[model samples]
Target: MADSYMDFTSPNTQFTYTLSDNPFFQKDAQNVINTLSINQLNTLGNVSLLDIFLSKDNVVEPHIHQNATELVYCITGGAVVSLINPYTKELLNFTIAPGQVANVPQGWWHYEVANQDNTHLLAIFDAPVPEVIFGSDILRLTPANVLAHSYCLDEAKVKDTLAPITDTVIIGPPASCSKQHPNGMPMQQMMNHGGMNMAQMAPGSYQQAIQNQTYHYPYRPISGESESYNAPLDHPFHPIPFLYRRWD
Candidate 1:
């Protein structure tokens, strides 16, 4: 258990907090993230969570939570969580539906893509506050000359390609982005042109590829079972045992 130096005997101690009041990132109402941490609820130990809502083809940009491991639980609809294993340098993808979860080890580069509309995921972390390093920030902040020299690419092209990324993109492609694909081809059309390996494609293309149903995921479901499961929207939130039970 995480030690807390709070004065529990004090009347100022807070026992309840509304997570929605604390917004982490909002990419419009449909694609928004609400956060909860020890800062918001002083009684909390070493735990935090992000309530994520995403629409179809929406992505939670690739990032790393350096301080804690994240367990993404699917509450409604479905999504694909992809992570790159540092040890093996392999990209692993997991398709999670309602009642399922995908875990990302601490410091691992990973991202999530909503496969269906009204997808809701709860990202729980083992730390009081989750610190992240987003891919967009790295790409945008890195000097174009440095990247070009390191990758043996054209400096001008690198600058042009990354110029549009003005800020941290938590959910993307940014709302202002007009082009969905690089070559002016729709994502589905590109996938239909020729089946390709998702691992070989750039990180930005993963969401579109997965949405088009072209990328093959590693895990396979039981033959008799359905490929995907959708939770009813009438009851959006599930009951959490810890919330109702007294720890004492």
Candidate 2:
């Protein structure tokens, strides 16, 4: 059956959208995400996407898409898409380079980490609007006393540990974070010494490290000029119309 809700003859019917103009979250010039949903394009049917750009060691952060299943496609550079399998109770990691892809089941906990500079990923969803529950929100919003009581831990320590997380961290560690590697080792150097397996640690280890506020992943410094670009948001919805030129 055709889409009965959509008015095909209406002048307001939109068929094209520029994802670059819409910024969903921007950690920095190197780390940013733009989103597109049915709201942007009225004719869309249960489809949405996020245009993600990241530098080395930058993470998309652990999150659950309760409303959609995600298919992550790598466009440039490389990334590690990690997800937790609720059935097997295993943390699975998939390293994808250009032309590779990873699929995350709906409601599964997952995250993506850029393994190289200029990593570009497109996260396509099966929902019109992907709803997310960020791990940072879970950690920060939950009552500290309740968490301490449930886990049999110190309440003050729990509160103190989570104090720094004042808002939803879509991408982390946040730009305000000042934590650095004690040994001053570059991420590439560390990976070379021990391989990428070192970064694929268990979730508990990550949680403990976060609680201690010492889990800062080292990134190789960008040599020469940085090619980071942030699209201006002042006029995101107003895209210039493209005119097709006839070949002579």
lDDT of each: 0.69, 0.69
Distance from true location, Cα of 20 in model 1, Å: 1.0
* Tens-digit lDDT track of model 1 for 145-229: 7678789999887775666555566786555443245456543233333423333445555444223332111222222344343
Count steric clashes of candidate 1.
0
TM-score against native, each model: 0.73, 0.73
- So what's the TM-score on candidate 1? 0.73
**Alpha-carbon lDDT of model 2:** 0.69
Question: Candidate 1's error at 63, in angstroms?
Answer: 0.5
Candidate 1 backbone collisions, by pair? none
lDDT of 2 by residue, 19-133 (tens): 8777777777989888898878888877889999998877787788877899999999898888889999977778999999999999899888888999999999987777776
